[model samples]
Target: MKEKIEQALFEVRPYIEYYEELKKRVEEIASTTDEEGLFIKLLEEEIKKSEEPFKTDLRIFLQKFTSFL
Candidate 1:
């Protein structure tokens, strides 16, 4: 999973400059066992609450980034 995220990050990071937090979150996801998937749930909730452009960007980033997952 970590390897997949690294690869996806390589492909997608350049397209999204505002991805530092997401990268950090990926690190969090990589280092620990989030059995309940609260990490992802939080992200989904955030996306739902986010305003335009940021929200769409996050959604698109998640979409492309999670394609490997």
Candidate 2:
């Protein structure tokens, strides 16, 4: 689970670093909500703009992370 979560974060790292809006959203979510719910909501929003592999990866990460929550 830790590995999966790490991979998910690894995958999104570049995007979050490149996009100020995405970074802000992540920071806001982190500040306002729990980790599992935060990632789920953020991934749901990001999935719309994401392509293959990462989109699927985020969904899987959300599913796995939700189980821990």
Candidate 3:
């Protein structure tokens, strides 16, 4: 699972700082918890709050995480 997260990080390397911190938090959260739905809900809320490029990036990141599940 760690490896998958690392791979997902690589897959989205070009994204901005917002996602960088979010990704790190995700890694931490994932390692410590099994609450997948919570992450999805969080991401959905973020996606709703975000503007264009970040919104698209978040969607893509969310899609990648969902694929991991």
Best by lDDT: 3
- Model 1 spans > 4 angstroms off: 32-42, 49-54
The CA lDDT of each predicted structure is: 0.64, 0.55, 0.70
Off by over 4 Å in 3: 1-4, 14-34
Candidate 3 — worst ten consecutive residues by lDDT sum?
25-34
**Could you give candidate 3's per-residue lDDT for residues 1-69 as a string of tens digits?**
566666776777776446776676556556654577875776687789878876877777778877888
Q: lDDT tens string, model 2, 1-69?
A: 345455545555654423444444445545555556555777688767777755565555455456555
What's the true lDDT of residue 60 in model 1?
62
Candidate 1 residue 27 Cα shift, in angstroms, is: 2.0
Using Cα atoms with residue i matched to residue i, what is each candidate's TM-score against the true structure?
0.56, 0.45, 0.63
- Whose TM-score is greatest here? 3
* TM-score of model 1 (CA atoms): 0.56
